[model samples]
Target: MTFNPYLAGLKTNAAEPGKGSSGNIERPQAVGNIPWQTRPAELTAFEMTLADALQAMFRDGVETLPDIVARLNASTVQHPEGSWTEQNYQSLMNRLAAGASV
Candidate 1:
């Protein structure tokens, strides 16, 4: 947790112009990458993970198991476990049937 831009060669008062140590402009951590930012690489929703989205889709569609799995693999949603094979899809349903949430 030890961090301070001064230790990484930045001036002790360094920050955005006119917003140094006393002006409240948030400083990026000096230990890692400079000019830090928060952004999603693939732009997925934060409201639910892939598993929850899959379960909801399956419940709403009355398709066959294979059809459901195929749609899941083809949809815009990304799988957390690489790809969703038939075995993995079955196990996901099994867990849901046993009252699991994402």
Candidate 2:
């Protein structure tokens, strides 16, 4: 399992959309060139963790599969087998894309 810093303040099962402790703030619209994408109906725990890590990495200018794998390994996150390799990382990506948690 990975320890993602990004997930620290997020609840696994969050409140209904637009509801929050601060009281129903409006959700922001897509800005600039960022296109709005449809949300997945649900995600597994592993998907959530991976999404968090990937978002953080992208914000930090981390791109490319090899680099992503390296950063993931260096962080608290590890692939299911233990550590990450490019091949395994791609394999996992494929499985996840196919809607498989493993």
Top-TM-score structure, candidate number: 2
TM-score on alpha carbons, each prediction: 0.38, 0.57
Kindly list the per-residue Cα lDDT of model 2 for residues 17-101, writing each as its tens digit.
5433355554545212222222223466777788899899999999998899999999877688889899998898887666455
State the local distance difference test value for candidate 1: 0.54
lDDT of 2: 0.66
Poorest 10 consecutive residues by lDDT, candidate 2: 30-39
* RMSD list, candidates in order: 12.6, 11.0
Clashes of each: 0, 0
Candidate 1: clashing residue pairs, number: 0
